[model samples]
Target: MGLWLPNLEYLNLGSNQLVGSFPMSISNASRLRVLNMSHNYISGSIPDTLGNLRNLEMLNLEANNLTSSGMGFLSSLTNYPALELLSFGDNELISGELPGSLGNLSSTLQIFFAARCNIRGSIPDSVGELINLVSLDLSANNLSGDIPRSLEQLRYLEYFNVSFNRLDGKILDGWSFGNWKNIANLDFSGNNFSGAMPDRICDLNSGLRYLGLNDNQLEGALPLSLINCTDLVILNVAKNRLSDTFPHWLGALPKLRVLVLSSNRFHGSIQDSIATSFFTKLQMLDLSSNAFTGLLPTNFFHNLKALSEVVEYEYDNYRYSVNVTIRGLELPFTITVAIPVFTCIDLSNNGFHGEIPEAVGELSMLLALNLSHNSLTGPIPTSFGDLAALESLDLSFNKLSGSIPSQLTSLTFLEVLRFQNNNLVGHIPRGKQFETFENKSYAGNLDLCGFPLSKECSNGEGSETEKHDQVNGKGMAFIWKVVLMGYGSGLVFGISMAYVVFTTGRPWWLVRMIERDLKEKIRSWIPKKKRN
Candidate 1:
């Protein structure tokens, strides 16, 4: 179109076969407000003159083959006092630093994104100059150096993500746990941030909701300050070097929904408060890959109102006596009580033994339950069928026995059911959700039979019991034959020994009689020999 529509306020030709450098004629559309030509075959540097559209408010030219020189095209947009949102993500642009001129944009700007553009170097301190910025995303870049402390100047900022960068240094003093009181979503994951968690992190209370600090070098005990943030919904601090007992303060957060503290150096018994008190609104909780022990509370699922509120509470009270009493009599009075509600609970990978509680199915809103890799025994509760919304259930590597619950087929929405490496017996349930699972899901249960497994159910003619009886009969027959042969051989040996001993007793007299008869015959024959 070559900017033929000068009156155009919005222009979008994205994902087309358009080619060549940006048309400089676009600068003629001084009234243009929105421009998008992303995912096209456009190449070469962006037109610096195109930024003359003073009324332009939103611009997206992402996912193209635009090169480094195109970065200069952005600096011209600073002249637009009305510009509010800008996105240049997912382009093969060369590495560069964020333009300091970006700080000069009008305070009316609300959203800014420059992810995956090879932008490197530290975030400019000038970023604090955009006081009205609400959402900022600089993720998936090569940016390095410390997160600027000046970021605390953004009092109105709500969502911020600097993940997947090479940024190093401790989380800035105020931003670490103190200043971001209005932040609802903060993702500093996939960075080189180090040091102990600041104590004031959870002091934001109802304002700070989702906190993701995983895959960092953060250490030290989980700060007790977390209990102060009664409005926290999701807390993820996985894959760090943190060392301490399981944090008990988690159970006190009134609104916590998802708590993931995996792959750390936490040790000690999983406190009963985990299951009995906290997590009332929890939907997904993963505490796997730690060194925890102790029996899981039997009533772990008893208090979950929606499988989300799984934190604990503190109670206190006071009493006083008044000096002026009615009718010249002295009187005193006192009252006390405080209660916290916790909903969902996950105590897997701990050394918990005994049967899973039937009350676990009471969590009607439970969506994902992972009790795998523990010492839990006994049959899976039939009550599990009551979880109408259950989506993912894993009970692998436990000592659980008995038949797979036929009622489990009621979990129509279940996408992942892992029950491997258990002692479960009986035929695998047929039809519906059971048939969808592969043999691996039911492996390590040698006594289990039916479809999906190689072993077939026993019939009357060749039942395992009948085969055992047949083998026992053959063994008895062989033993009896060996005994008869031994008795016959012993009789023959005894008879032969007795005959020899009796026959030799009269042998000497028989020898003398024979000698006298032989002497007479010899005397007659000797006389004839002498004559010869």
Candidate 2:
């Protein structure tokens, strides 16, 4: 009776909670072109009868408990002549080496996804036989060993993600990386790729957009050819052994936005005298945990034209990530909400010395700026108040002196401000957001005395008594700025208000009454003048 529908082309019973082993009788539809039983409770080995479906074009058994100790099932699927998309991901597969027969899959295959499959051993060299493949995602597996050079033959491959694995070896100089000219998204992160990045990397893909090689041991200077990939948008090579000056040449890439080179051995001053280009569209620039010195590149920051404009960003379907506090826990900000708020400049843990640049205030869209752990001196830049979007500012552990900029109180969105361990003097700024900060925010700055701190100023220095509070600098500790926090602005205003009311509200006010009473007392003392 099953043979009555021998010409059935589609059989989709997905997500039906169907239990028990995948039935072998499905192959009776000899001309079946699409077979999908994914997201079910199917178990047991795949029957070799599936190979009988010669015309099968799409096979999806993903998100099922499909575990088979046999190795023929993977190879059997190769028998189809029109098979293009094969997805067996998110399944509990039997632990075994991926069969080499997968290399025999039809050349028409384009998308192969086996991520999170408990497949062990090295990736089969025969995988390169799927020459027409476009997207290959075998991530979250225990697959190790170097990628075979034969993969270079896949000229049409577009997206390849082998992240979250133990694979090692240099990505270039071995494989014909030069042949991946059409590849757009390549993620080799979470591996042990070492050695200097190839100098001719740009020769591989002229239109590549996202390149992620982070969490590796890659060393040496950034390939100068990297800037030639003018279409690059996100370049993440963080957590490596890379050592070089700031790759200011990256500014040449017009479409570049997110560039992360954090937790590396990159050294030398970031500022360059002759570079005329600008990272106009850059939103996230992280160079923390390096050896960078000298003042920040004010000229370069001035050219971040995207930052100077009003709040506008291009993160619609895409995502941006940076370290942030999520529910009181430090975590990566990877939310996909419609908020397009993601811009930071991290130069912390470097040897940078000099005043915080006023040019940084030009980035009206910046959300976080970390200039901590440097030798930076001079007062906190008053221009920081212009950053209406700033939420985090770390100016700690510097040689910065002078009073805290009162203008900083204008930062309404500021939630994190660390001025600890600086040489700043004078009373800390008062009012608004300043009042919310605790004593620790101004700790180590002994000269700063204010409400949050226990130290209070001498008496009679309130705003109303400023004229009488003056004393010799050598004879007494002359206080210049009257602390508005301890004595209170409302108290001074109340006294001034009382003075105005008593003097004007009555014809015989306190001043007139006192003068009259004093004159009569003097007349009584002189009796002869009173009798006359």
Candidate 3:
């Protein structure tokens, strides 16, 4: 069998349970152009002899156990002068420093995916040599240190990712950004990059679609230059030190969809300066853990047309994810074919007040909505029944009063409902999702009385009338007691006055005094004529 398939141009044994170290005999296939053995149980060190396949154009051994003892095997890869693609990612045991020889790959190499290989130490600056490389991913590793600036030389590089690593330092400017006019996706999330983000990012070529710089220490106001990037779809700057007001102007971007500014210092009211402004296509809007205040704009919900309509887009083998907080848990949401839809609005832990907007119920496609830990008051809108697709709703730690809407019971998909520590009262609507809700959902509302709560209500008119009669009888009895007390006091006063007159009878002395006074007055009076 040695010479039987010596000219094999392609050998694909992907997704099989294949195992063991690299087959050194493959070197005999001198003309092998493509070899794919990914998604297998392959183990042990990759053989250095694999480098002998000179005309190999693509080598994909990803999702395996290609553990290497040293840098020699990576260095040997330089021999494949025709290699245009290298895929060695997700090999959990492939541990060691990235060899400088990685940069020696043929200039024809256009795509390199070596992520999650558990490789240690900094990326070598020599990676700059792959002038024709289009995509590079090195995420989910323990690698640290500034991304090698020399990567600036890969003018054709479009998709670059170094997320979920311990990489530190500023996302310094001047990394061949000007050359990749066709750059579509760039993710630098989940790292320790600090300092002000370079504003030059807005000056780059225009086809950019996704930009992620979340979970970093970057600060300062959001760059106004972002207005130029009208094609941006997903922009995540959450979990950073950015201290800007709400970026309302971003609403002008016609295609903008996912916008996450949580865990930052974004302040001010969500505005609606332009009726149909920025969020025309937005699917998720998270501004939680900030200083936002005032009523959610009157037209805020009306403008998010995407939230009201059903939007379906495939990730198409790409991981399009955004982190959102649902029911006190931080979860990463990704677009997928199975569920393919997620529209959310999270404005929790701020100063938002007044009634929960009735228009919010218009978001028929919403999956999760949270407005907890705010000063909000008034009734939970009955219109919330319109959120037929809602799975989670949180309105806890607020001043919301009035009865729980019976209309909300129509939300059959609701899995988590929380209204604890609010002023909600009366019966909690029953049936559907309401039946699944626990007592805690209505706790801290003293006026609330229902099946889940300990308080019970009078069911019939006779029972209610009996209660009213009992209260009325008590009130009438108190009023009669006051009247009787007043009548008795008047009788006692009349008797006392009669007794005073009878007890002071000095008749003779009174008569003598009256006669003396009359005589004295008659003697002293005289007419004027008698006096003349």
Report the number of the highest-TM-score candidate.
3
Off by over 4 Å in 2: 1-55, 60-73, 91-94, 176-178, 310-329, 334-341, 425-443, 447-532
lDDT per residue for candidate 3 within 1-532, as digits (tens), equals 1333787977877668987667778878888887877778888888778887888877877778778765566678875677877778777777778777654474777777778888789988767788888777788888899988888677776677788899998885555366667566678899999988767665764666678899999999988878878777778898999998888888888777778898898888776477565576887788888898898775878888777765554432222444445534344443311223246788898899888778897887787899999999987776787776777799999999866766676676676778999987666656765776688877888877777777776465234433543442222111111001110000001111221122234211112212333434324321121100
* TM-score, predicted candidate 2 vs. hidden true structure: 0.74
Clashing pairs in 3: 251-278
- The better-scoring model by TM-score among 1 and 2 is 2
Lowest summed lDDT across 10 adjacent residues in model 3 is found at 482-491
lDDT of 2 by residue, 1-532 (tens): 1344787988777667988887877878888877777678988777778888888777777778888764567777776787876777667675567667664474778777777777778888788889888768787788898887778888777667787688888875655466678776677888888898767657755667667888889999998889778778778888889989888889878877778888899988887774555788776777877888888767878877666665354543322222222211133443111233356777788899977778887777776788888899987776676777666788888899876666666676677778899997766656666777788888999877767889874442233123321220121222222111110010001111221232244211222212333445434322231110
For model 1, how does the per-residue alpha-carbon lDDT over 1-532 read when each residue is reduced to its tens digit? 4656779887777657988876778889888887777668777667778677888876767667777643577777777787776667667674577777673484757667677788888898877777777667787799899877778878777667798799878776555544556666677877988998657765556366667787889988887877887766667787788988877567677766567787778887654545455655554556777777766655555655555222343321101000110110112111011122111244556666788887786665554577888898987887676665565577889999877766666665565678889998766766566777788888888888878888887664235433433442221111111001110000001111121122344212112222333445434322231110
Question: What lDDT score goes with residue 193 in model 3?
Answer: 93
**Candidate order (TM-score):** 3, 2, 1
Which has the higher TM-score value, candidate number 1 or candidate number 3? 3
Provide the global lDDT of candidate 2 against the true structure. 0.68
* RMSD in Å for model 2: 22.6
